[model samples]
Target: MFGLGPAAKSLREQEEQAITVPASKLLLRAVLNLVVAWFVFDEARGPMAWIVVQFKPSLATSVESSDTVNVVMNLLYYGPVALLIAWFFGRMGRWPLVWRRYGRPLVRRVVDAIGSRSGAGTPGKAPTGAKAQGEVVVDPWWAFRPLVGHGGLALLDQETAAGRVGDVDHQRLNRALECVRDYPDRLAALLDAVREHGAAACAHPSGTRDLPGRHSGRHDLLLRQVRLGSAEDVPKNPAAYRGVDLAIDPALLGTSLLAVGPAGTGKTRRLARPLAEALCLQALAGTAVVVVVGAADADLGPAEWYDVVVAPGDPASRYGLDLYGGARRLEEAVARLADALLPEELAPRAESARQALQQVVVPYTEAYGRPPGLRELALLLRGEPVAWDALREALRAGGGLTDHQYELAQRERMHGQVDDPGALLADRLSLLDRPALAASFNRTSERGGGERGGGRGAGRPGAELPLFAMHALDHPLRVRIAVPEHSHPEAARIIARLAVGQFLYAASTRQDRSLFAGLVVDDASAVIDVHSVRSLQRLRGAHAGAALLLRTLMDLPESLRTPLFGAVGGRMAFPGIAPWDGKLFAEAWGTVWVDERDVTRAPDTSGGIIKRSWRAVRTILAGERAQTESVTTRRVERRRWSPSDLAQVLPGGHAVLSLTAVDGTPVPPLLLDLQG
Candidate 1:
């Protein structure tokens, strides 16, 4: 106390003197101004007095007397005016002392709370008494409580840095989060606080930079709003990374990706690699299902037929092909599948083992003009099992049979030829004595059988029409029956309709994998009819996502476009080598169409002469850019170049990608590999 005695006394004296100084001066100024104003406007004054006298001569004399009295009274008015001035000075004096003691430290705390960094990054504290424009002061606890209620929000106030973390009624904040009707209103207070405190001190950055906005946790989720032209131009190589190709990250948001290109643009070949990869992934995971649906069953023919006899080990296990162990099991499963999925009348014919005897017995009797011997017919009916070995042996014997005898036999029948007449005759003469033929003894057995008769509507009776044959065995995963190339467009449409039906049924019936990974229908426009395409509306109802591929944007009829094209969640495009169609597709998908510009030094050449390279451009469903080339000839004998040629000449896969989200957000540059 002694050490501070002299200094403390001096400081107190200075403070008192400083307070009185402003008070004394303001009082003097107020009194002087009031007195001056009163005298100058006195009753006998020069300018105003003359005007009043002239307007009313009689009252002018009387007014002069009253004015003198009023001047005196105005002097009295100066007393209160002086008091007000003193009061204002006194208030101003108090503020300085307060700032020196408590105010400076508060300001320091605020500045320390917020770092120096700007650009709306990081958050910092606002100074005490710092206020945003139009923001009213309210209980800070009210603001803190609502923010905390959002869950996962860290309470970071200016005082937090000063070790003064306060309690917020988190329950209220959580309620707000659960019922956030007006996001802008809900975030208004927080955004105001952020602006005052600066971004560095705020718990979260406002999403907007130029203005205030609330940012979500996902930084990668950009809400970039932009106006897209009919055709948006893209870079040839959007992704700078060479080897690391950008692919559909299955882990991210689900998508409906469309891959479009003209015929022979390597569309199928490009997809084959990914298809194989997808199949491999499914096989390896043992959880995914792969279903291939296409028209001609030739690709699956080996699985249906050869596997029955050879019982071969997994032929292409890497590619996920597993054959059934036995023909009976396969047939039974196929039958079960047909019964469960198809209408009752459309089931495939199931030939019993007893009916197989007609192949040998009828042939001998019909052609040789006699019935096959009883022993031969009996042997054929109750025959030794015709294993692969026996069939191979029969082919080896020179009596018009060999390992490839059946195939050769089929070819001969197709060409209406036969061999070994004598041997067939000997066998046929004895068939008349067989007990099985007793009822129809007079009628000669016909070797060539008519088409199996069954079913109506979808399949006609005795028409020998190709039918969808799906096996219902407990497949390890899923299976898809595809539309064949030879199938009529109508048939393909029906198949697609059935495909959707299958997905819906599976979704409703099975709890496991209820959400299909995705449905990818290629060349959809050519194959799917308007009604069938419209059926896509019910996809989500069926709990399945679908990605459809079309050749051109025009391929989809206007009626179907409104629903099918409009409903897509994402879009991608690839321009192919055709000027007209390619440009149309490009414009439809909103991708920029870049043509080949010859910026060379030819005297006759225009400075920026661009070649009308492609006539048609194809866009993937996702609106990603792809390059398609066209063949243009100067004359009949000129060279013909295809899209493949252009693709090869293109500097880095020669593709452009346009991506738009359901919310109309423009996606940044990305590369979709359409290569094998």
Candidate 2:
């Protein structure tokens, strides 16, 4: 029954009508009682008549006179006998009312004693009240359900009232209780404790563990509980509910973290900054190697923590990213660079450009025994004979180049076609030629004066940029590269793409899974592509992870969004999200069945009129009676948190975390307020 109208009337109104009898119903009940009384009297009258016959034998001889006398005597006996029987039956009809008024409390007290002794108390029992040892005070209604058992009520209360336990923990506790019940000694001790105090008395102390500066274990980077939301009434025990502070285990993070939030929502300050700081602490302790990529103008915490700051196009920066430093082989480096410069949709052109660039790169490396910089590569693509002597010497020493190779190089030199694929690639890469940008990549030294021919120079093998070098993952290194997208959007994207590709390649090469690595990219939507998606999918196995911050998913191509969502092991969504994004999260969290309680009330007017009426000598009494009933129903496959609720209802500084469990199941979405 559904209660869907005005508020309920008071209890006094209900009780007043119960005692006052209704004239019509009372008359009907009285008549029925009189009929039952007559039946009772008839059964007893036969025996009485026999006794009378024994005393007056002469009266028994005359049948007609005896029958007449008997009828008269039976009539005389009806009033007293019937009246007495009717009163007795009337009392039986009121037994339920009597039990409710006087018997229930006595029975309830006995049940409470049994419940307390068994480590389960009544619903009204206060948690702070003195409970018997090992007694678990819980909602009595929950205890009646076959599924809930004794401990389930306590777990449910913790989850609903205190928010101390989660669904996963609830299931675990159920299993643990089952195990404890199987062992007599342990079970006895547990019950004793529960009876002595209440269930909450056994809860762990409310405090968090101190995070060490460094940790050897890969999974030790923990998100500490900074604050709690004012709106949340749930009391939390830091020790008991460790999941409140997210633990980004290496396995979970290996796939990646996708954080989506609007600007000025503390995504950077709360999520990104804190995560970076935690990673840096691990780096300082020599546990992990971290790379953070963001705009040059953004404040990404302390600079001292970073071993190298590579700001492309920032003349003041001390380090630069070598585009070719990602791979040991020249072909691999060229392919990776081409992927960064060209979108996958331009497959034909991208492939042609990669092949054209590799032809020059491979030949040049063979000639000069070193990789060329952006400047040297540009010259070669333009058909300049800058390294002709080195080429000729290498050719002579290697017993001469094939005629085809020589002809191709000579014809390119002679023609110098501007429309060539190699030239097109060079044009796209020309951004690196800018004075400020080129200076960063031109030298291996702190300043750009180490060589005449840029960082690697001719015949001088250059050290790989830390971003790509194999050894970089082995050390506690922090590499921060700033690409100011506003001034140089293409350059920023190219650098970001290259950094991501290099990290992915390096991650795939890792032999030791214990050492963890991570890449943090702020405003990543601008740079995410097919390669980034693949990298996210593969990173987990290599003990490498990524944290990508995006303002929205609108910039992402529709085809890539699903894969991107599937690839990341965790997602955090802040308030003010678009409806579509909220829907995605809603689906990720999925649906669950929940219990819904419906209460209904109907007017009950069964009581008769009272005798105390006066004004005009007319009787007056209460007109309506209220009857209430409760019914529970199930809501199956309903979304746990609706999209509209998440998009608009969540307060500022709050976000929902949908993290993947190690078992590959999605954990239910949890509401978290980082700024709390």
Each prediction's whole-model lDDT (CA): 0.35, 0.60
The number of residue pairs in model 1 that clash at the backbone is: 67
The alpha-carbon deviation from the true structure for residue 554 of candidate 1, after best TM-score superposition, in angstroms, is 4.0
How well is each residue in 229-318 modelled by candidate 2, as lDDT tens digits?
Answer: 222211111122323554454555666888887898777776666566556655544356778888887767655556667777664565
Candidate 2, 148: how far from true, in Å?
A: 56
* Tens-digit lDDT track of model 1 for 1-676: 0122446535655565545445444444444444444553453245544565577677645545798855664454344554564454334334455455557989988787674433244334444455868977654444445444443234344345443431211222223334443676856664454335432322211111111121212111111111111211123332233333333322211334455556554444344223322432332222223344444332322222111111101121111111111112323322222222222122222122112333443343333433343344433333324432343354355343433355434422422224322223223323322332221112223522211111121222222222222222122233444443452344344344444434333333334442234444555554344333444444444333445556665665554454554455444444454454344333345433323322223222222324321111111111223334343323132112223433333232334344443334544333344441
CA lDDT, candidate 1, residue 264: 52
Task: Compute the lDDT for candidate 1.
Answer: 0.35
The Cα error of candidate 1 at residue 509, in Å, is: 8.1
Top candidate (TM-score): 2
Against the correct fold, how does model 1 do in TM-score? Answer: 0.30
Residue 386 lDDT in model 1?
42
Once model 1 is optimally superposed onto the true structure by TM-score, how far is the C-alpha of residue 604 displaced, in angstroms? 25
| Deviating ranges (above 4 Å) for candidate 1 | 1-244, 251-253, 276-280, 297-476, 487-493, 504-511, 526-543, 570-572, 575-673
* Model 1 lDDT, residue 99, Cα: 52
- Which predicted model would earn the best lDDT? 2
